[model samples]
Target: MKKKKISLGDWIFNIFLGLFFTLFTLICIYPFYYLIINTISANDISANGQIMFLPKGIHFQNYIDVFKIPDLASAALVSLGRTVLGTIGAVLGAAYLGFMFTQQKMWARKFWYRFTIITMYFNAGLIPWYITMRNLHLTNNFLAYILPAIVQPFNIILVKTYMESISPALQEAAEIDGASVMKVFMKIMLPLAKPIMATIAIFAAVGQWNSFQDTLILMTKPALYTLQFLLYQYINQASSLAAMIKNGTVISTSSLATMQTPTSIRMTVSVVVILPILLVYPFFQKYFVKGIMIGSVKG
Candidate 1:
């Protein structure tokens, strides 16, 4: 094939596009760069409110201090558990529900499907949701993190619609071989549905990991607190940090002074909270795109 020459208009458009994207990319990167710089810099550099396009007087004490915070380890464990279990539960539950919704054996599928769709558009207010969870005795329990999020209507619908696009003959053949619905789902459908499930898993994990509101509302016990809520308390409640300083670990008055005047350790906490998701995202990104695009266009 002969190469086509680019028109002057196309050249101009490409230049503009490149410039726009460069600016956008810088905008996105700036915050993380600032956080890293502030996190690594010495207390004096950070306290001076220096313009930090680049790091100054680098040190790692901020991260050390963040680690030294009280219950941070336990809270991290809770967050990690919630992310893993909640993601698996939500994805598998959605997949199973999606599979069942397509089955002839499911009773009142139309009514239930419509009802699920309706719930998406209309929500009972937060007060009712809070009261309902309270009445159900979910408060101060780890179950609060995973159970409430397991049934994601949007995800179920995506999986269901994608499943519908699978050849009916495969299902019929399995049924003819005396393979039960559960067996077929476990052996066949799930394996074939990996791409979409990966996509939903990312969504579910990020949501569960970053869920601060639920912890704040549902948990009163310190032991039940998630990393997100712990960080939130550190930000909003000075007394909380003061308590941590008294009990968690000892830091110098100068370290404490930086927080009071200029430098904020909360930036380090933000980086810690976000770092895992950032690291994990690239692995799922392809699947996320593939799942949404294919699931949308075909099914």
Candidate 2:
């Protein structure tokens, strides 16, 4: 094959494009960079706040405070459980139901499918939503985290589209061999649909792990709070505590002196909260892109 030489104009454009994106990427990353430095640096907390770029003094005590905070350990456990259970529940439920939607034999599948799709666009608002959860007795319940995610329409639609793209002959062959619908789904479809499942599972896991609004809305008990809600409360406490310090209500001579400043602790909490996702991402990186693309393909 003959090689086409790049024109000077093309060379200029490519260089410009590369530089533009490089700057944009750096800009996007700066906030996380700031967060990292602030979280790890001890001197920055007590210093005159002059330094922004480089980490001032290293300290793990901020992290210690995060772990030691009241109700936080329990909340961390809840967040972890919710991420695992809620992700599995949402992915399996959505994938199974989505596969069922592709089956012609399923009763009222169209109406039911349409109903679920309608839910994607509409909600009854906060009051009715609260009432419904209350009636279900989900208020102040751990089930609130896992149950609500089990039937996400967005995940269903993604899985459905990907499943529909599979050959119908696969299912028919299983049926001819005396395989039940459940067996076919369990033994065949589930295995074949790994990519899309992984993709949506990532989505569900991240959402479930990060969710705190539901806790705020439904949970009154401190024990029931998720890590995120605890973090939220910590941020509020940070502001309130700062106000107390400024007003001299919380004297430096008191126990507050030994306590990690709310700002430092808040940053530590952010790092702790996101650390799981960071660890989990590398495992999913290979399938993540493929799953998203394949699932989005038209059936």
Candidate 3:
């Protein structure tokens, strides 16, 4: 086949589209880049807004100081623990319920499915929610994070739709053999539903990793503090310390390179908290769009 020549209008349109997207991409990326450069630059220079577009007075000491902060390791562990455990629980629960809902013989299936989906549209109010958590004795409990997220209705819907698009013959064949329901789910549906499951897992993991509101309302123990909540505390403390150092009321024990300021603390903590999710995201990104599209095909 001969190549078609591009028209002037088409070329102009393509150029405009490319420029628009480039500007949009830069807009999205620049804020994170700004935060990183600010954190790595000298406190005085960064405070003066001298560093932009590129870092000045490059140093890794802000990260070092952030690592040295009290309970940071523990808080990170809490965040990681909740994210991993909660994501696993959510994926499994949603997968099982989604598969079950697709079964024609399931008792009161429509009612239960409708009941679950109703939650997405309604809230019982914050006070009632807090009281419910307290009543369940989940306050200051790690289960608070895992249990509540395990049965997310939206995840179940996605998984259900995705599974519905799979060949029912595969499931029926398994049932015709000596395979049990659990075995069929494990050996057949679950493996086939990997894409959508990965999508749900990513959703659950990000939500779990970023969540701090539950920690604020449900936790009283420092030991259970999440990385995000601790970052909030660090920002407040760093502000006070920055003010004190400025007024000459406190002397710096660390060198100029490792000094902590509110801006540095805030940006460093944000990077620390955000980096893991960012790193994990690309691995699941391949399945993400495919999963959402296939899962939305039914309804």
Clash statistics: count for each candidate: 0, 0, 0
lDDT of 3 by residue, 225-267 (tens): 9989988777789868787778887565445445777778888
How do all models score by TM-score? 0.83, 0.85, 0.88
Root-mean-square deviation of Cα positions for candidate 2 versus the true structure, in angstroms: 3.4
Point out the worst 10-residue segment of candidate 3 by lDDT: 250-259
Q: Which runs of model 2 end up more than 4 angstroms from their true locations?
A: 1-28, 43-49, 248-262
lDDT of 2: 0.84
Residue 197 error, candidate 1, Å: 0.5
Query: What is the C-alpha lDDT profile of model 1 across 19-82, one tens digit per residue?
Result: 9999999999899988888877765566567847877667677677667779998999999999
Which is better, 1 or 3, measured by lDDT?
Answer: 3
Residue pairs in steric clash, candidate 1? none
In order of TM-score, best first, we have 3, 2, 1
lDDT over C-alpha atoms for residue 25 of model 1: 100
